[model samples]
Target: MSLALNIHSQRFQLIATAVAASLVTAGALAAYNSVSKRERRRNLSEEVLRSVSNEASVHTLPDYSVYKEDASNVRYDEELIREQLARNYAFFGEEGMAKIRGGSVVVVGCGGVGSWAAVMLVRSGISKIRLVDFDQVTLSSLNRHASATLNDVGTPKVKCLERNLKQIAKWIDVDCRAEIWRKEEGGDLLEGVDWVIDAIDNISTKVDLLKYCHDHNLKVFSSMGASAKSDPTRIQISDISHTIYDPLARSVRRRLRLLGVTSGIPVVYSTEVPGDVKLLPLPEEEFQKGPVKELGFFDDFRVRILPVIGPLPSIFGLNIATYILCELAGKPILNPLPIKNRKKLYERLLRDLLHRESKLTGETINKLPIDEDDVGMIFEDVYLGRSVIPPHLVPSRPALTRWILTQPLTPENCVVMEYADAEKHVKECSNPTIHPRDIWGEDVNALVERRSEEVARQRAPA
Candidate 1:
């Protein structure tokens, strides 16, 4: 009987324990669902509020219907516009501000780099901008894009820029072109723009656009290879011929040179040698499928994506914007210092030239008439960093030597040559009887004279 009673007690206790555990789990689940519902409601409420705010902002923009034909002519409240741009006006002053406000810019490739450039340009008082891109905003773009949000996904990038930029400066004209810029139709797209910003990533397209701009005498600024670059200090603005330590610049320079374009294009590039980062590899199955180039959206576009840290492209954009703004304000950066210690190279070249001259003249000369800066001008600006001889190859061991030994060392007489070529010229043409034309041909002499005269005119008082 007692055993039966104990068995009943154990059974009752087990039932109670099971019922208590079930109640706890059910209560916990109910609480969790309550919290989850609250979170969902809160998120939905915030999203709705944000949407309403965006709509309100759009509606509040100054009415531009009167100047529909030319939105740039539409006048806004003078006090509001000035207040919006007061900080910029303070720095650039009235005339500079006027120039900036009147200037128009066209930004191609509205991606991480171009988008930021467009935003800053608008914010800085640029009255007109044209955005050209044939891409859609993806989920991944939000990290680096200047104004894209989750809501902007699947929208055209140029349209996204237009919508946001219009909100930033109600009076500004934002022309959105949602088509690719082909060489055949690019002229129409770029027509009447004060500046063109080339933030294109595709190598062939970039080269084509730059060449087109060069051919048409368009004022253009290009951004080079911001992917996989992190160091902001390494960024620089220089003519394309002088760009160094950048693979994109090197390839573009070579192609442009082949097309008879050696220089005169300004570019923003990173001097930092790329690290171990590489283009993302294609899957093995992709190789099994066929040629990788065939898989690209278009021929010559990169099939593989580059690994980009979000901040690098933004920095590049800022640099481009800063450069363009200064230029539009008529305060161009005439002498951007190359970060790779080019001054040391110039100094060394000067020393080598002095030594070579001492050997030829049989005098221990401590100095020449020209200084290191002159040497740099002669080597870079005058000769375009190549030998003034047949083939005009970029010298492996570049040396600046006197073109005419009889003439004293001066900007007009100095020339760039290979170290060995300089030595050979010293040995063979050092004689008072020999003329440079006899050895280097009359064409070289004429080229040198033309370059010298150009330099002379440049050095003359304005």
Candidate 2:
């Protein structure tokens, strides 16, 4: 009995020893992994800094140690603005709205996107904002810059935008910096700012600014080449790594990657083919008065002389502001994961916009033979969900059903079937009558399912 007891005691000790050894190994591994992750992040940051060293060397940023507490004294009418922001209440709730109202942003480069984003942030209850730009409004900027008009021609863009931003929300604080934020100059601009909105057009300047933001761990968002795009349907918000087609995004991404940064910056860009684009030189009379020409570099810069569309830049600006606010509010942002997978980014945004009515008119999606190439001719976004009409098939509207359809339609190719669509078909018939629903046949279900599967596959994250 004593021998048996001794064996049992020895086995118990062995088990405890094994457990202690396993715990020691696990603890060491955990510590090693944590240190490794921090090291990787530090290395990535250093690499990107090296990539932009030349540009960053142009100016030393001013010390930020002195002004961090300056924001504490800035006055805000929180109660009044909260009442005005009642619509946002549904999105962010009272506590969240307060966070937004107390937020601050600095928009660099007060051009088309910058000007518009500034106004959006103001109206969304951002109390403090700083606008920076060296360029003044000119004859040509009137075509694209939303805040500038003929009366404001030759005036600094930041002041003009600041004026417009304050006019909407009188309690909001607007600080205007009209000088160029040179790569070598002071970063006093970023002091106490919660977000830095990068609306810069120059690649070198953008690289420098991005490097600073990454190094400081500042939350920054950028706008990429808004010029020469015509498709209003293709504007998308995505990370720097996932962008395609836009030359500005490509340049920024390539340069940042060389610096050791492969992701973490979100950008607003367009993927649509710039249709019928031709780069025209500044008309001689306009060149003398143009804001773009005021920059010394424009004497030889051809890229800056590209076509400027009316609303495309504004769309990018609006999207950037919306993404920032929505993310802050914890609303579902159309995830950029789709863009990363080479799937339809803008089309998904279009889909979200057109989701007003649930059921679409059968005529909107006329069952027909279609080639993928014919997508442009057959599909378009309407007040209801986007339609896929076949030119060959005529439409027929049924009488009011007095009920809303609860069945969800295919999200990819959906349009609305309104209960009151009969009112639109009054010209076709003297009497209101319901027709027999046409059968789509067996292939219809299979086709929809197949397309959905394909979309699902592409949409899944890598």
Query: Candidate 1, residues 385-452: lDDT per residue as tens digits?
Result: 79988789999999988888887878888888988988887777888899999888999989989978
Point out where model 1 deviates above 4 Å: 1-75, 283-304, 340-462
List ranges where model 2 is wrong by over 4 Å: 1-79, 282-304, 330-334, 340-462
Q: Would you estimate the TM-scores of all the predictions?
A: 0.58, 0.54
Q: Would you list the clashing residue pairs of candidate 1? A: none
**What is the per-residue lDDT of model 2 for residues 1-462, given as tens digits with 9 covering 90 to 100?**
454435358787898889999999999999999999999999999988886786855667655443333433534345555666778877788777777877888999888888889888888878899998998898888877968988899899988887777666767788889987765664888888888999988766788888888878988999987777788777888888777655456557757877787788889988764444445666666645434422121232344466778798899889878877876665637666434423353343333323322233334433322221112211221111221122212223211211112333333333222223323322232223421122223453344445445333322221
Q: Which whole-number lDDT from 0 to 100 does residue 236 have in model 1?
A: 83
lDDT, model 1, position 203: 64
Q: What is the C-alpha lDDT of each candidate?
A: 0.82, 0.63
